[model samples]
Structure formats: structure tokens, C-alpha cells
Target: MTILFDQCNENLAAGNAIKLFADYKVDVLIGPTTNIPALPVFILATYYNVPLITWGMTSSAVLDDSPRFPTAGILSVGSKRYTIYVQ
Candidate 1:
């Protein structure tokens, strides 16, 4: 399966994930840049017809707001101490 990661800031983490996917013979695509917008992520997923996964706080907000995301997935990798207050 092909998976796309959104707004990946650090190369080290991204690279590690990519390597892992490669080991499993899965196709992986990182975001175009480290600061990709939510809109672009949606567009990319639509264009590629692949699932999108994101990490951290900002990504949580995007996933929560995007109800129509096609195969869009989010993996919350933040610490358990983090809490989100949505008003």
C-alpha cells in the first residue's frame, strides 16, 4: 500500500519511517515540504488515491476537522500528557 506522510518537519524521523516502509516493501511518499498545508495534503491524497497519516498536535486538528478526507488517516504520536481543548 502507498502511504503519504503530511508536514513532516524532521528528516531523521521521516527517513526512519521511510526505511521501515521500504523494508516491508510498501511505497511511501513524504510531503513536498516540511510545512505543508492541510489543503495540499487533501489534494495530494486525492491525486494519489492513497492514505495520508500525520503526527503531532496541528495534525490532530486537521484530522478532526476533515470529515470528508478520502482515506485520510492520522496517527497521534504525541506524549500522553498532551491534551486538546476544542472550542
Candidate 2:
């Protein structure tokens, strides 16, 4: 398997992910880490028929929606559960 890395510049720039897909033609996408950036990238990965594995700070409940992100998987604890753990 080939691995490529690109920085999203800590922003919600789906353009970076687009460039990777268009230029490198990656089969799978691993994450933006943060919830905000991961959101769009996950959608893009699904559109491209690629799987997106999310980790780190990407704990948005929205990411848990299998219907929305069928090809995506979240490795981090979800926000709701994390909150419960914290409290």
C-alpha cells in the first residue's frame, strides 16, 4: 500500500484533500484530526468511494452517521461519550 500525506493547514480546506485525490489518486484517506476539517473530507472520501479513518480530535457525533459517511470510520471517542467521561 502507498501512503501520502498532506497538511490541511489546520483549516476546513477540503481543497487539500481534493488535490490529494485528484493528483495522487489515493484509495483511502486518513484524517484531518479535528472535527471541523474532517467533516468535509469524510464526505469527499465517500464521494470518491474511498474509506476515511478518523482519529485524534475528530469526535463529532455527525461522523457517527453511517448513512452520511458510509465509508468512514471514527477511532476517537465521540463527543457525547467524552463529555460523559469528563463529567
Candidate 3:
């Protein structure tokens, strides 16, 4: 199991997560930025056929009805939920 992290979460959060995964013999990849298009991650995961997991709030701007990527198995955790209002 490998994990990917974005720049915003590179402090203690990243350290802890990496340690946890390492304990389980899982490799981790920390990206410089989280705003990269989900396509790359999706493609990489699809090519490798490995499961992907996210540990922070993804940009809600990209998660509307027409999401940028397929979120079938993607799991996200955050303190607050994003509210959408349609004009």
C-alpha cells in the first residue's frame, strides 16, 4: 500500500502518515502540490491497478456533479463538508 500527499500537508501530518504506512510495509509518495489534476494520479493508479486514498479535503471546485475524475473508490476526510449552492 502506498500513499500520496500534497504540499499543504507536509508537516507532522505527513510524517505521521508516512510512519504509519511504513510500519505496514507500505511505500509513500509526497507530491509538492495537491492541486495537480487528478488525472495523473488516476492514470497512475489505473495503470498499476493499485488502490488510491486521499487524507485531506480535495478542491471542491473539482468535485461538482461533473467531477474531474472518477471518485468511485476515493475516500476523503475533513472537518467540514462543502456546501454547494446553485444560482
Q: Which candidate is the best by lDDT?
A: 2
lDDT of 1 by residue, 1-87 (tens): 544443354444445444434454434333333223544554445555556555444343344444566655555532322444321
Q: Compared with the true structure, what per-residue lDDT tens digits does model 3 show for residues 1-87?
A: 454444454353445444444455434333323424333543443344344454344443443222333331334522223442321
Best of the two (1, 3) by TM-score: 1
Clashing pairs in 2: none
Candidate closer to the true structure by lDDT (higher is better), 1 or 3: 1
lDDT digits (tens) for residues 1-87 of candidate 2: 444343545343487778777888887877878877788888888888888888888888887788888999888998867777899
**TM-score of candidate 2 relative to the true fold:** 0.76
lDDT of 1: 0.45
TM-score of 1: 0.38
- Which structure is stronger by TM-score: 2 or 3? 2
Query: Could you tell me every candidate's TM-score relative to the true structure?
Result: 0.38, 0.76, 0.35
Residue 56 error, candidate 1, Å: 1.4
- Indicate the worst ten consecutive residues by lDDT in candidate 3: 63-72
Between the candidate structures 1 and 2, which one is better when assessed by TM-score? 2
